[model samples]
Every structure is written in C-alpha cells, then in structure tokens.
Target: MFGGVSGKGRTGPVLAVLAAAGGLVVFGPAGGSADAAAPCAGRPVKAVGFGAGELRLYKGNGYACAVTAAKNPGTRRRMSVTIQARGSAPAGDSGAYTQLAGPVTVHAGSRCVRATGAIAGGGSAQTGWVC
Candidate 1:
C-alpha cells in the first residue's frame, strides 16, 4: 500500500501503478532554470526494482537525451531520487544546463530527487543521480 504523501500533497496515479506492480518507482518535477521551453527538458520515467529504467529528457530547440539505468542485479527495494542543476537555462540555446542526476535513498522525513546521468549532451555527469 502507498505509505506517504508527496510534496504535492497526494500520491499521483503514477505512484499507484508502481504500488500495484509490486516494485519501487520514483518520480518528480523536472528540475532546472525557468525558461519558456525548459519544461520540456524531461519526461517522467518509471522502473521496476530489478529492471532498468529509461528517462527521456528534452532540450529546448528540439534536442533531447535519454538516460537509462543498468540492471540493479540486487535485492528489490524502495528507491528515491533527487535532481539538481548548477543553474537554470535561458530562453534559447544560449542557456547552459548543468549537472543532473539522482536515484538516491530518501532519508527520514525527506524526499529523493530521482534524476540520473549527465546534463544532456557532453557535459559533466552528476553524482548520486538516478532515474
């Protein structure tokens, strides 16, 4: 059964799917600077506790990136993630999208970010990131 309410004050439909599937699932709003197109940066992703999850990120101006996790090959358990970046992106391609990653454990009374991998194209990869 679902145990807690998210930052949004309710368990969304996506979470319900995870609970029914009997595996860990993580999700959160796409993080980054505020730009007109920034909202398209990433789409929500889902994964089974043991299988790999695929995260699709959309960059402004039609560029996009996909982040995938290698199979855990370990015990199935609850997973959490946190997504962060150096700064926000500008209105156009001139803006820079910094580090983005998460899939870490959620601490007591805290939520996980849930993003993982590099910013998008050829940038430094973030640490403790998961999707």
Candidate 2:
C-alpha cells in the first residue's frame, strides 16, 4: 500500500520512500503527510514579492537558501527559485509544485547574493545584490 516501503516495521511508521529526480520523495496518506516544511534551511533573510508569489531568502552557517512561496497555495502550479552568490555559479530549482519551489542553497560566506522567483505566470527578481 505504501509507495515503496523502506522502513523495518509493517504497521509502526514504515516511512515509505523512493528517490526521484535526485530528491527523496515521501508517499503518505491521501490528504497529505506530516513535516512538510519549506525545502530551505536557515533563517529568513529577505522576501521579494511578485504577482503570483514571493521569493524568500535565508542564510545560516555560511550558506544561503532561497524558496518561492505562492501567495495562495493548494493548486499544483509552476514554481521556481534562484540564487546566485557573487563570483559563484547560480543555484536554483524549478518545477510543478503545490505550494512552493526551491530551497536552493549555495556556499556564500561573506558574499552578496541576487535572487529570482516565479509562480504560475508571474515572476520577480532582485535587480542588485544583497548580503
């Protein structure tokens, strides 16, 4: 019944799972599952708003994170988030998501960052850099 049972127990929180598209995806009951936190790590640094949603940034322990949060979530839609550290290649995420996208992280110790986000058909981006 589980997506792909991987745990040791049968009726004691099996935690069914499987790797898909380079990410670990979990399968749960019909309504939804628990622990569905945003994909990023660290404390929020900034939030850039757009027509459909907002781009959120976070920084912690010498790393930077980014996520695109839909203003009104629930429906599956295209979402994306991108962040680029000064003198470093950009890191980002884009796909069909129910509420948000990304959590794209990159090493950004003492460096400025620029970011962009898109949801549905709307988009937003940072014109300059910020730390």
Candidate 3:
C-alpha cells in the first residue's frame, strides 16, 4: 500500500518551511548589525614619513620643534623622537614621538629630525618612538 508516505514523510515539507522561516527570522535584515569604526582613525603622525629626507615633530597645537634625519650612507642607526601629549605631560608638557632611522640630529631652531636607517615595512624606521 501507500504506507511508505505515512507518519514522518507527511511532515517533512512543514518542517522545512518552519526551518526556513526560522532562518529568515535569525538572519533577516532587521536582525543584522554593523560594526563601528575605532576612535583613532587616521595613521598616527609618528608613523608617517619614514625613510624620507626629514621628519617634523609637533606639539598638540601643531607647533613644530624637532626634525629627524635619514640614515647615513653605509651606516645603521635606530632613532626615536617623543612629543609630549597636550596637557598630559608630567610637568605641563604635551607632545608626540615620531621615529625614523638614524644618525638622527635635532638641529637648533630646526623643525624636523633625521633618522639614519632603511624604512621598515611598517612605514617607519626602528627608532622606537611612540606616538
């Protein structure tokens, strides 16, 4: 007889429809959510201009104070620069640290410093300066 399509077979389509509806409920557009971007968006100023000719260090108000130099020919050096954070200084100083390869010299009255080394893959020399 038609005993093959008896108990469980008749409910298969219903179960499938329920499963599909459940899936829709779980994965619907209304249930989806988006992620927000981080508070710190742009590249850190210290991470820019590595292996270049010179680098400039600025205070919170964008006042330039120091410069970094590129690595000397046939020489390897690690250079680092630190700019104190605005109003966060231990003794009322605020700036940032931009590092580059060196032989770095901060000349008097100069607006940039030099790092004497090859630029690493991270877009900065290994001066160990923290922004």
Candidate 4:
C-alpha cells in the first residue's frame, strides 16, 4: 500500500519488484515490469546494501538502475525506495512512495543517482551513485 503522492498528484498501486528474484508485476500507472538481470545488464556499474535484502544492478534505456523484489509481510509493514541525483540530499530523494510490495526501481538521471530501499527497523540498502 503506497502512502504518498508525487509532485504531479499522480498515484496508484505501483508494485516494487525484486530484481534478484526475477519477479514481474503489471498494474495500472502505479505498477509495471522491468527486466531482471542475472549479473545485471550493461557493464557492472555500482551497488549498495539494501538492508538485509538483496539487490541487482542493471543498465538499459539509457539509464542505470537497481531492482528489488520485496513483498510486504501482510503485517501492514511498508517498504520505501528512494533516488537521489548528484549533489542532492537524501531528504530530497524522489522515487516511488511507500508501498506494500516492492519491486522498487530507482533510475539515475543525468550524472548519476543513488538508490536505496528500507523497511521499518529493517535497515536500508543503497546503490553506488552512477550513470
């Protein structure tokens, strides 16, 4: 269940998919599917910790990104995905809002962006800032 709105006031049931698990989901505007990478697509860029969870890195569509297949434990718990452009503060992170299931895909814009995922008290994981 997502709980926030984008600046455009657009919102829906977007699902966060885990890249390592090769999960796929198709929803309205809120959810869609992305390619899963074994070692990841394109040249291995960078990767960071995604809490206790696992993550995969990839590059496609002129963008570098990290994908995760995370599902809510049915306890009303929420997972968050964030993306920060170069020189941007974590507080300025812009990405998917908190949701029940995460296949959160954070993309790098321009120079590079840092991506992160986390659950309540579950810590967080991040990716190396890259193209």
How good is model 4 by TM-score? Answer: 0.41
Better of 1 and 2 by TM-score: 2
Q: Give a tens-digit lDDT track for model 3, residues 53-126.
A: 34443322323233344433333434433333233331111122243322212222323222223333223433
For model 4, how does the per-residue alpha-carbon lDDT over 18-121 read when each residue is reduced to its tens digit? 33234433332343334332323454455455544444455555555454434433344445655455765542222333332233343445566666666565
Instruction: Select the stronger candidate by lDDT from 1 and 2.
Output: 2
- Name the candidate that leads on TM-score: 2
Best lDDT among the predictions, by candidate number: 2
Q: lDDT of each model, Cα atoms only?
A: 0.32, 0.76, 0.36, 0.47
lDDT of 3 at 124: 40
Local lDDT at 57 for model 2: 84
Distance from true location, Cα of 12 in model 2, Å: 17
Clashing pairs for predicted structure model 2, backbone only: none
Model 1, span 28-83: residue lDDT tens: 44446355333334433333222233332332222223332323324332322233
Ranking by lDDT: 2, 4, 3, 1
Please give, for residues 1-131, the per-residue lDDT of candidate 2 as tens digits.
66454555564444222234224324443334222464677777888787888888888888888888888898899888889999999988889998878778999998988888888676665625877
Clashes of 4: 17
Native-referenced Cα lDDT, model 4: 0.47
